[model samples]
Target: MVLLERAMPTTLISMLAKIHGENPVVSEAKGVVPTCTCALMPKSGGKQGECKWCWRILVNREGLWFRVLASRYGLVGGRLKRGDRNGSVWWRDIASIRDGDASVLGSWFPENLSVHVGNGANTLFWLDRWVDDVPSCVRFSRLYDLSENKLATVAQMFSWGWKIGGEAWKWRRRMWDWEEEMVVECRSLLLTALLQVDTEDVWTWTPDPVEGYTVSVAYLTIIDRTPPTNNVLAALLWRKDVPMKVSVFAWRLFRHRLPSKTNLFRRGIIPSEAQLCISGCGQQESETHLFLSCTLFGHI
Candidate 1:
């Protein structure tokens, strides 16, 4: 053994002490927070309000919303939990499922053509390759720009048109439908990572858009609000020459809220009055009510 010259820094010694098995006690990456299952509070389950992690990142988001199962050798495994809001931090997994979860891909598809019967084996093999369900499911796979820092929004679904006879997939129904479902499923997977919305709504997990079809989520976001009455309501978006309606302008101006033009005039215009009106108390509705002091406007 060689003789040591100087004592190591206490911080360095302490960091070394944190080593458990082969993993380090402390992570070097910034903007990353560690969480324990215990800290995860169940918003739905009986564990109502208790936080699960030792410390929670104030804005701990899950990144990219893509799916990957890291499993291998019964040692490492878990799903990439909240991939939506983008907790873009380096993750040092204590355990990962490197091969176990992905085994379906290798097992489902063999090198023999008999294994890929008419439509039966082929579809199963396709899904396994793409990490999709064997049966129908809304797929949302996408390639995100990790370096650009700007996120891309992939359309959630698109219809698949395949003709089995000539060009329409060339004269087959089962194959066409199978092919179509596969195409749409692939699109779904791509879109899930691209868009951030509560898919449980009437939208999401629906049929793909038809060819040459488009839908604006922006339009869906605008809530039905009260309309505006006078030219003052139109503000800059209004003029006889402009030929614009106050209601239409109101949406562009305030991003869709309220129930009607008159409602904006009465309730959303002033803050206290709407609250007071229902309470049978005192509240005034005015331009200041409509413009300066309303929760609906979102000016702040």
Candidate 2:
């Protein structure tokens, strides 16, 4: 049998242990806490100009795996572009997760992931949460809708100039007096925003900024956000005494992922008429019917 069923429980437990083992004090006092720089300092790349004092140097960039995805799917401002209909299965799945299509963790990534604007070259002007807690597109929906170039990056817009009569204010048509006031308000907000010409924009994971992103922490966060019923079901699904295949079967049954006739019909693997229960109960062979409501197997 496959190791999928047996490994899940052990993996979950290990992840939980790792999450619990992290020091609460260290995590909370991350940027404020001072540390000894005696032996841990870099040997070769000591201090370079203003980089030594800049916190952007500590921000982690995307890894090889993410870079590979970006290369295949296309990248916009150091982030993966939205996947199209012609994209591969893996890419589409990833895109769905990024777009908050996942039922369990809706909008988690977008809510937690924020950009620390530096040169502004690698941050979206309207979509990224750099200026405020929410994206500019959301905060100024009316202005965003009127904009001619909705896809402009922060640097691009800044270069064009963001002042009232600047070239960056390219709208579809003339704005009303109220809209002009809104633009003034928007410009006023950006007045204090200073862009560092040398530093590149950095993406930060809000949950654990110090250690950055980790699979264990992400998994734990997802589990914590899941509904109590789902958590309870998952806990009950992987029992130490249960056989691997049996556990797998139960999991599939519960998830409606088993190859039932109704599911097969839905996937176009079987004809609609052929989706009747094999037990001849004149009902669709769905997980609920086959496992719990079937007169033959259900009672057995």
Candidate 3:
């Protein structure tokens, strides 16, 4: 079997070092034994990257922390019921940084977050994830990529006259056949949402059924977004007769993460070898060949 050092992220190994309990030392060794619960989780910044737990703690503070900070600084930011110019500016600056660690953390949010359009002053015309719970940019990505102005606001797009600081139509005057079709599609979609200029824009958090953000709801949202895996033969793993450890091994095997020669070679745990079959076949080793196809092992 592969050692835990070879399998888990290095940051977790470092965290395990700081824990002090009856079995204080968390080793790099791998076995079927369960780890101790007394291990202390590492704080914020660590060797590999900012802790995801820490990142969540920070991002979820958008509702409360920013307001407290803004009140202290004589400025405003974060989620709003009735959008104001100062609050809108504050949110735009923070939300649209569009890169690095902060951006990565922001992507963890599910599509459940939505905007309640009012005056449309605070809502971004294209970049923000709003239409049918998806960003207009993502929905009409091709058109967004081709558009001359990428950062236009919804108010600007809906405004009738350029005389009052409304944006003039900035799309390319000439369009290819495909682009023309996309434009038609965009027009059809946009025509359905009419803006109410007198009303104030409301940023809505819809992760919970009750219409507010909660720690539990956020945690559930994150859990719901786990990356999908295709474990086609997973049924064999949960059979009543199988040992728990064996089921775990079977699960890892399906993920192509078992400590096979090919996995070790691919994971850089061992140097490349020309052959791996115990029966002396010269073929390259892989999960498929090791468990299902190798002439010697397949029949076992």
Candidate 4:
């Protein structure tokens, strides 16, 4: 370990990598011996995000030491030692645990690992800690290589199998809470789109009274809600006592007769739009000429 007078701000991995993973604890590879290779596998264990194989559980990389684990852990799915039988075989079932026996880790180990057990086994690995220079992409490849022994989802394999720069991490991975919430939100949005719930109900809406009435109604979703809200006057010409669009003429008269911003209709204050025009034979074309007092239509 190196100590410095000034502080050095760095990433967690860089810090750990500097002190430990930087140096290969074991000069030889783990699980490379010709011994039994029965990596512990989970029978039904992805729920807790823990590896089922090699019951040696860990929260993160801090627990990557073999000395702390030793015989207490089951082997995770990894390379098989030379004499290693299938997964069902154990040290107890090996029939022989001696260093040269073909059925145990002791047998196929390289000369460095061929010595005493425990401390020696630990020493071999301490000298051979993982090669730090291997890119994270390569690190992921190692994991996937080990993962091939078990069932895998396409997403999982793609996630770990992908290699980019020397470093690798889940590029677009979501946390459990975020993933769950987004799934629900997306499902609802999709359903609404399929049902067309936010569309206009034109068929059930009141029919347009003129060529431009539909456009006016379209603008009415928020600006106006009924016929009275429109600047144009409306009259029920098709189904009323006045069959000749008389009501249309009547409201038209009412609008121009009143002043701008007039409350005439608001409280029935003023006269008609026709009243604002000349009263026939005169200066203004008031309602008198168009219908009632007009000399044109013959004084209705």
Best by lDDT: 2
User: Candidate 1: minimum summed lDDT over ten consecutive residues — where?
Assistant: 46-55
Once model 4 is optimally superposed onto the true structure by TM-score, how far is the C-alpha of residue 14 displaced, in angstroms?
65
Model 1: residue 216 alpha-carbon error in angstroms: 34
Task: Note the Cα lDDT for every prediction shown.
Answer: 0.25, 0.62, 0.50, 0.28
For model 1, the local distance difference test gives: 0.25
- Deviation of model 3 at 144, angstroms: 0.8
Which is better, 2 or 4, measured by TM-score?
2
What lDDT is reached at residue 254 by model 2? 55
The positional error of residue 110 in candidate 2, measured at the CA in angstroms, is: 1.1
lDDT, candidate 1, 36-96, per-residue tens: 2112222211010111110011112122101011110111111223222232212211111
Report lDDT (Cα) of residue 58, candidate 4.
Answer: 17
lDDT of 2: 0.62
**TM-score, prediction 3:** 0.42
* Residues 92-137 of candidate 4: C-alpha lDDT, one tens digit per residue: 2222321223322222112111111121112111111121222122
Which candidate would rank higher by TM-score, 2 or 3?
A: 2
Candidate 4: where are CA atoms >4 Å away? 1-173, 188-213, 225-300
**Estimated TM-score for each candidate:** 0.19, 0.54, 0.42, 0.15
Which 10-residue span in candidate 3 carries the lowest summed lDDT? 40-49
Please report the candidate that would top TM-score against the real structure: 2
Report the lDDT tens digits of candidate 3 across residue range 33-145: 11332122222221112222222223343322223223323221222222345444333323322212233334444344566777766667776665566776788888787
